[model samples]
Target: MTVAATEPRVVAARRRVPRGSARRHIIAAATELFARRGYEATSVQEIVAAAEVTKGALYHWFGSKSELLTSIYRELLAEQTARLRDIAEGPGPVQERLRAAALDVVAHTADHVDELTVWARSAHLLDDEQAEATRRERRAYHDLFRDLVREGQDAGVVRTDVSATVITHMFLSALGNTHTWFRPDGPLTFAEVGEQLVALFVGGLRP
Candidate 1:
């Protein structure tokens, strides 16, 4: 579709463009368009117009559409990973740390559901290098989270019957898919939903 046709729906609801940051605007515009129209349907030209930036500016920030998509995921993952690291290393009992980590990730995902949703839908379209890089970073996050579970298991608080790998995957898969069913206007807010999910996750870990 033409930029004019798509701009209204895509740009109207996006976060306000930051001053002197064409990169953020382009990323924001691309994310909205990708989430609403699917990756394959959004074109470079359309994103430029919607972002109100030149093609040169977009290309300067992102090498290509694939890079932009990967950047979106990387940026979110980086923030989440940093938060997880802090929680994992902070002074707390294993169970408490794990619970806090779980709650934090869910809240972060809920807060950025739109961007995560875009990544979920379009990650497969990324080039091999981009895909592998993201996978590696994601794996690091999972490993850190699994170590927390292992810590709990070793402490004899979390169940030993279930493997840490299995527990981690189950909880994360559920959290990762939250964007699929969650709605801001729904009867229960994501915060409420996240608390319940975290409870279920921590409860399942109990021996």
Candidate 2:
């Protein structure tokens, strides 16, 4: 029996999803599993099962467990980079812009705590190549915060004596680490916590 022309076209189209998309699906599945079960506990076989793909497919996309983790890390870093870029480019007073950016970070972390947990847990387990790649991506993200601090200083909106590096570290440490304590159903909204943090940094407790 001969197949219809449209049937052949549909079959061809089904076989032609972008290579990058397939890899992303694998990474996303692995990320969820790794978050629920730590790196030492999760197996590649289990990851493939959760992803609903063959072991061969997973292997074809990411050569090793470390590589898969690296891919997820890069994906997260890309997301943060894009968000920070938008906040940095937006018009507002420096203080307002910084507050908005901090709030957005907290909100994002709260929403994706699972992914962040996976990233934090597996970051140190990466191979040397993956480690270096993660470091570079992290630095790019960090630079955005650093620039915000510089802008605050230049505008005389924040303390000039405080190093931009220190400020940036403190800001991220507070925002990113919220995943450890934040509950989606908690009494305090992410925005409230973010505002408190911004206030602490911008206007210290001293009378």
Candidate 3:
């Protein structure tokens, strides 16, 4: 029998993570610094100082700066993935689920746009192992979404002429790139944008 591939790669945290405010401080500090200054420009020393935590505390929470960055993005993705699973599995028509999923993701990203922007800009700096793991997790998320599209197509609600892959990427691309042009102070609110995008998505899928 062929051996299965290795387990998913996760940036392992140091054992004996103590409960305290230090860990929260380190993450908050790192996120703010990384957003203000590019990831490569930010240093561990700066993070610890800004957090007002000792180097020992930061190290205990995260092994390295890159690991910290990876963990940040991973945490966001984990939340999105969990929410997607719930909407996908819950009772609803396929189109309704798709609309809800799309809107939910757009809203979540808008809420965390700063952290999302940091990841988008610095994700390339991550180590190969951590990066590959994230890619796998993301692919799983995409596959779950694609499955929803396929279900719609099978139900005769979504057009079958367009491939599910195309539909999936088309809508996801629009929603995923919101950080590029979205502005909180801009005329258009995120809720407004989300509603319009959902309308376009659902309309395009109609057979």
Best by TM-score: 1
Full-model lDDT, candidate 3:
0.87
Higher-ranked by TM-score: 2 or 3: 3
At residue 82, candidate 2 shows an lDDT of: 94
Q: Between prediction 2 and prediction 3, which has the larger lDDT?
A: 3
What's model 1's lDDT at 95? 89
| Cα lDDT listed for each candidate | 0.89, 0.77, 0.87
| Candidate 1 lDDT tens digits, 1-207 | 666555444545535355578988898899889888989999999999899887888898889898988898899999999999999999979889999999999899878888898888778877788889999999999999999999999999899999999999999998788878888799988878888899999888889
Tens-digit per-residue lDDT, 15-89, candidate 3: 432458888788888999999998999999999888887888888989999999998889999999999999999
Clashing pairs in 3: none
| Candidate 3 segments exceeding 4 Å error | 1-19
TM-score of 3: 0.86
Shift in Å, residue 4, candidate 1: 38
**What lDDT is obtained when candidate 1 is compared to the true structure?**
0.89
* TM-score of every candidate: 0.87, 0.79, 0.86
Model 1 TM-score, all chains together: 0.87
